[model samples]
Target: MDIALINPFLAAAKHVLKTMAGVDVRPGKPFLKKDDLAKGDVSAIIGITGVASGSMALVFTEKCILGIVSSLLGESYPKINDDVRDAVGELTNMICGDGRRRLAADGFSLQAGVPTIVSGKDHSIRHFADGPRLAVPFETDHGAFMVEVAFGKPH
Candidate 1:
């Protein structure tokens, strides 16, 4: 896997958590995983394509998601609802967008892909065997979350 492709995601995650969620996030070691899936309460994923092809997923527990969403929205959400889902989706999208721009500047052109939100316990996301997958774990003030990246052929 290309380390160049993973830097943007790390930068974007730090930026998004600090700017939007009002929380400082510290990234941990990056690891390569064959399957990156979690049995968690809340998981949001954003896929990007164009010059580059891949998907990025953010997964965390429901409590952690709610806390982050509440901080970003400046209100307390008692439970997970449509608003929470939308906020999470948008956050994931922003990270992807920022990552795309950074990667583009580095000579990799990427197009925006649709963002998807998934919630519940014990759910899993699997990627195709077309390319390498990287899993980056992060710790935020609210809780722990993970970012999963899958890269395909460059576009």
Candidate 2:
């Protein structure tokens, strides 16, 4: 995977988390994933088309999301509920849209589908592209989450 492709997402994730949720995020090293098992308890995924045909997913641990949503909406969520799921979906969409906007400035036209949220332990995330899955781990004061990207031809 090209580092260029991943850079936009890294920046966008940082921007979105900070501006929207009032959370500070630190990105860890990027790596190739070897399995479909989700790294966290919940995830939001969105498909991309146009210049890049692939998918992006944001996986969040329970603690991570709770902290984010609580800061974002100024409300405490004891656990993942319908409202939490909606927030995850919106967060995923915003990240994808912001990243796509950056990519567009680089002359890569892209479009994203509506985000899909999934929850549960040991859930799997299947990307639509046929290529190596690049995952970047992020740390926050509340907890940790991951950003997974797969950009290439559709499978």
Candidate 3:
């Protein structure tokens, strides 16, 4: 695994939530994900290509996302509506962009595709890479979420 590509995302997730939504995030220990099942009620997935190719997913429980969007937009979200889904996509894009920027400083060249949203119970996140994904779970006052990254070979 190219762990060098993972740290930046962890940092980016924490930074994005705190800076944009004012939500302080606590990241849990990262572990290898052996299944495709998403950890939350909603997920934003983006494909990455360049020095390495793979996919990144930001998964959020309904309550966690509700709290985040509420804080981010200064409006209450009673449910996971279109607005909430849009927020998930935007957040995924920003987090990946920030992570790519950081990696660039270390000589990595990466580009991200548009994010796609998936929501429901027991939905699977089929990553671009066919292997165990690095899953990093996060917690906030409202609820918990997770970030998963699967890396492929360097191009």
Candidate 4:
């Protein structure tokens, strides 16, 4: 994976967590996984298209998703609701927006598409393009989560 692309993702994740959730996050050692990249059974996946073609996914366990929603709302989210799902979708959107901006600054202009939330167990997301897919793990006070990015030039 290009450090250029991966660095922005790490930065965006850190920035989003701190600004939106009031949580400090540290990135873990990043590695590539060809296996299904989805987390647990449910994942909130969002894609960005334009000057660049790729997708970004926010994968979390049920508990982790609720914790994130609670932190963002400054209230306890004991159970997942429409508000919680919307919050997760919007949060992923922001991360993708930040990433698009960073990429543009680096001479890669892009536009983000709508984020889709997928819920299921043992389901994996597949990116079948001939480009690098980076999986970055982040640790926060609430828990750990992952951000996955995959991109390549159009054939």
List, residue by residue over 1-155, the lDDT tens digit for candidate 2. 77787789889999999999889999999999989999998999999999668999999999999999999999999999999999999999999999999999998888899998999999999998988899999999999999999988798
The lDDT values for all models are 0.79, 0.93, 0.94, 0.74
Query: What is the per-residue lDDT of model 3 for residues 1-155, given as tens digits with 9 covering 90 to 100?
Result: 88999999999999999999999999999999998899899999999999889999999999999999999999999999999999999999999999999999999999999999999999889888875699999999999999999997532
Write out the backbone clash pairs for model 3. Answer: none
Clashing residue pairs in all predictions, respectively, total: 1, 0, 0, 2
Which ranges in model 1 have alpha carbons more than 4 Å from their true place?
153-155
TM-score of 1: 0.90
lDDT of 1 by residue, 22-91 (tens): 8888888978877556636677776677655777888877777888888888899888889988887898
> Candidate 1 lDDT (Cα, whole model)?
0.79
Which of candidates 2 and 4 is the stronger one according to TM-score? 2
- Point out where model 3 deviates above 4 Å: 153-155
Which digits, one per residue and each the tens of the lDDT, describe model 4 over residues 33-140? Answer: 677647553466676677667777877777777777787887887766778778878888888888777888999777777888766677777653447778887777
TM-scores for all candidates: the values are 0.90, 0.98, 0.97, 0.87
At residue 79, give the lDDT of candidate 4: 67
Clashing pairs in 4: 41-120, 41-121
Worst 10 residues of 1 by lDDT: 121-130
Clashes of 2: 0
Residue ranges of candidate 4 with Cα displaced over 4 Å: 128-130, 153-155
lDDT at 60, model 4: 70
